[model samples]
Target chain A: MTATARRVVVTGLGMTTPLGGDVRSSWEAALAGTSGAASITDSWIDEIELPITFAAQAAVKAVDVLTRQETKRLDPSAQFSVIAAREAWKDAGAPEVDKVRLGSVVGTGIGGIWTLLTAYDTLRQRGARRVLPLTVPMLMANSSTAAVSLEFGAGAGAHTPVSACASGAEAIAYGLEMIRSGRADIVIAGGTEAAIHPLPIASFAAMHAMSTRNEDPQRASRPFDTQRDGFVLGEGAGMLVLEAEEHARARGARIHAELLGAGLSADAHHIAAPEPAGLGVSRAIGDALRDADTTAADVVHLNAHATSTPVGDIAEDHGLRLALGDDLEHIAVSATKSMTGHLLGAAGAVESIFTILALRDRLAPPTINVDDIDPDISVDVVRKDPRPLPAEGQLVGLNNAFGFGGHNSSLVFRSV
Target chain B: MASEQEILSGLAEIVNEETGLPTDSVQADKSFTDDLDIDSLSMMTIVVNAEEKFSVRIPDEDVKNLRTVGDAVAYISQAQG
Candidate 1:
């Protein structure tokens, strides 16, 4: 509300996912309830003992999209980030802004785990001399934004904000604040993650946090279902070009949505679980609405961070009910991770993309595999069919992300 | 995996790869952007390649002057010094 927080707008978007390689295809696949998940076929799978042998792997591998040398130099996380960022940059018409006036903020839940695990093995077997010199930069948490900054010459600032699952949404929030604070005119913001390898899969599986619907990978991530076990691991990146509303208008850029507001809260109840009381989560939603200078009725569609886990899906439901109150039933709720799986840090960004699309297109995508709802939770779940938006006023969509460290983040995107 | 002269040419390859600067346009004394129009990414590639080819660490301060082939060869000479 202060002069430091200017109005930020979303101008361009890009995504790479299991549903499809491009934004159009991914959106269609998501709405149609097509799954991006499948059984792991890579030789890397043989090395780890995971409870679930399937995940929502990217429809297009980074190596398939990038040059072989590019794949060799950058980690999977960086590769996915580059692919999505290039799409967004190209989508933004490759604006020639001042390098000092352009900034980048990309966050990931897990950075270059592939590189870390691989390099560690190389050090043990092949000796330190054989390891690539670029390993450190490739594996660092800020690698995506760093690569993006170098590409676009964004010298003003390049930062990475990590908050577990909320990382991507937080990155977008940071970008909005940066422009509002007069630090930069334009920023490329998003999140990416590629932790589908044996190490992470085994680790997550060991924690009993992954869905074990191996035979039916497509139906594995059944969010909002009474029988829902856990989320399926996913790997991909989602990126957006954020610019000041005035700057976007001056450049005549295509406005996808307006970044209305963002709210952050800490549960402080558990390290890897949500507060059963849903107080902190409710506060985060309320905070974002207040930050956007809007009310509950403004948000027509809600992108819930329901990762199919029993506790997570219901906790978000309780939080949504508390935040929306009587208007909760009218807000179409879509559990995207049911189709795309859990993207970890990239989850918020990709889901934010989903939210933006719902606003721009006026259609809320469905939360697939709702075989048996509790019947007790009164929230209206969008399932099987995408719901149409109202014709009159501005459309606002909310994205929620809760992380392992008791981090809760909410972002509001309004149709421009 | 490559020779030192090859490393210089390989260094040139990095410049060309990232910046698309012409081979003939590249000069030893020329500043990367001032003369050849090399971008920051190209410079990063050059460092990555130099470390790979020569197995030497081109300190950040040393890379500041590495604009041309001569600069790279000289840096390698000094780093290898």
Candidate 2:
């Protein structure tokens, strides 16, 4: 941490999640403990005979929010990105910052899967010339970043971090550094995912990474519970307008929360499974607290990356216990993925937004479907209803996101 | 073979569908790029749809010669003949 490093604060937030189309509605549904998971009724599920038929589809389709021309040009992932970015830009009061001083970073675990698969299908069925001209651009991993960058004329840089589920948190972290490093005054950073198609669902299910509780889709995602099977696949996008503290103050922008710092690490233990002892997870958390110049004692809330997977939840518990030590008991831990399902790449960003809201409102959202809590989870898990945070002073919260290939990312947020 | 007026009407529909231009506004003298604001990608889409509708092939090289709707209509009529 350098003395001259600029402070980064969140000025705006936008999202289109399974809970709702916008941030407020989604937050409200989260507070009410509504489950976004439902049985996917798309005919392709039946055609493919997928083992997992349920997923958390976006509450609002992108076609409903975007123009016909925009939809024709962009893939589903890019469509979600553009929709969220539009809201976030408007939420930031549509700042008139110089185009060269602005930037965008949108991360995705899988980019334009629908586009790629569909284009291939078109080629196979209708021949080569029938494929759309924009297929390559739409299927690229950086398409969302490019779309948002073009939307706002962000010239400082357009970056896409593809670290699986950790992608979103990494993007937010990158935006924080962009401001701190004096590269950009404001950066729109987050993640979007539209991988609810048949192929992805089948692939994840083949790895036994998804729950098969098709009868009760709402209760399928049971984090920190004994009966938990696996994660429920989800689709959505989350975005945040991150600005330098000085730039925000100079422009009189309304501040949402302060992004104190981020810590990222790799496990190198396994490709898909987490390290049993959670050494990498602890290091990331410890580094984040250290980077934020704060101790575990100041932290009062946590938005855990409990994807409801059987071993994954236990591994994260071990990691949290190792990092926070005795202070872990004091933090009100909430696994909002029980409501939003596992948003994959967007999970970290959406969970970050929930953490910010928790700090702002002094209330932590609940972790639903924990009928029988796991005894191994020693942390204080907020369940059923929203829990109130400390009312007296500045509160700090942490959001963790771990991805496949041993990627781990943790972000710290402090109330203003 | 379709009449010249029918070819123009069919081409107008394809152009309208591809670029969202009004069919009535797709005049014979209107330039696909300057007048209709259709870019090259959209022109390709329109060409493909026109090929399917009129049952005539418009090669990639000849697409450049289709500067105006009148040129496209004339080309399709001759190709069909």
Best by DockQ: 2
Q: Write the per-residue lDDT of candidate 1 for residues A1-416, one digit (tens) a residue.
A: 66456688888788898887767888999889888899999987777666778999999988789976678768999898889889988888888788898999998998989999899998899676556667798899999889889878998799899998999999998898889888999999999999998888888887888988899998889888888888999989999999989898888989889998899999999888889868888999999999998999877899999999978877888888888899885788898998999999889999999999998889999888888886655678898878898877789889999898888999999997
lDDT of 2 by residue, A236-272 (tens): 9999999999999999999999999999999999999
Summing lDDT over every window of 10 consecutive residues in candidate 1 chain A, give the lowest-scoring window.
A126-135
Q: Name the regions of candidate 2 deviating beyond 4 angstroms.
A: B1-17
RMSD (Cα, Å) of model 1: 4.6
Position A19, candidate 1: lDDT: 82
Residue pairs of candidate 2 with colliding backbone atoms: none
Model 2 DockQ reads 0.44
Model 2 TM-score is 0.97
Across B15-81, the per-residue lDDT of candidate 2 in tens digits comes to: 7666667799998999988999998888887887788788888899999999999999999999999
Proportion of the native interface contacts kept in model 1: 0.00
After superposing candidate 1 on the true structure, give the runs of residues whose Cα lies further than 4 Å from its correct spot: A3-5, B1-81
Highest lDDT, which number? 2
Q: For candidate 2, give the lDDT of residue A285.
A: 97
